[model samples]
Target: MTVQINTDKNVEGHDSMNVYFTEELRTTLARFEDKITRIEVHLRDDNADKSGVEDKRCLIEARPENMQPVAVTNYADTTEKAFHGALDKIKKVLATTFEKQKP
Candidate 1:
């Protein structure tokens, strides 16, 4: 699956960052490889410089052929946490979506 990541205002665009993000996504959702056409991840810092509870926001969108895109968002103290949180939500959404499509 193709993966794209975007950071809002706070973070700079970098090849290293993209590679890391894509690698993490591939590792996390290896099982859905063939079914997913594309995955987009958006990360934003609620407070550019502040550090506190759940300030980072992560949104993940998964698009599968012939199906509506599945999307989820979560907030946490770090990108990893927010990502996993969103992942969990998307997993549930996809499960329900697939069930509805099954005969």
Candidate 2:
């Protein structure tokens, strides 16, 4: 599956982070590799210039091969936390989604 990440101006979005997270995603979502076409990760700072609790936001969208895309969002103090939180949520959602189709 293809994975891409997007970040707003407030987020640093360095190359190292992207590479690490991309690989993590590939590994984490390997089970759905054939059913999913692409995965998009969005990271941003809700507070912009100011620092506050849960200021970091992460949105993860998964596009299934022939179905509507589903997305999940999470917020936390740090970007890593927010991203992982969203990742966890998306995993649950995707699991429940596919499970429903089982006979």
Give the clashing residue pairs of candidate 2, or none.
Answer: none
lDDT of 1 by residue, 1-103 (tens): 8899999887565888788778888887787787889999999889888887998899999998877888999999987788789878877777687778779
- Candidate 1: deviation at residue 26, Å? 1.8
Q: For candidate 2, give the lDDT of residue 42.
A: 99
State, as a TM-score between 0 and 1, how close model 1 is to the true structure.
0.82
- Pairs of residues at least 3 apart in sequence or in different chains that clash in candidate 1: none
Q: lDDT tens digits, residues 1-103, model 2?
A: 8899999999999999999989989888889888899999999999999989999999999998778999999999999999999999999999998998789
By lDDT, the best candidate is: 2
C-alpha lDDT score of every prediction, in listed order: 0.84, 0.94
Q: What is the C-alpha RMSD of each candidate to the true structure, in Å?
A: 1.9, 0.7
Off by over 4 Å in 1: 12-16
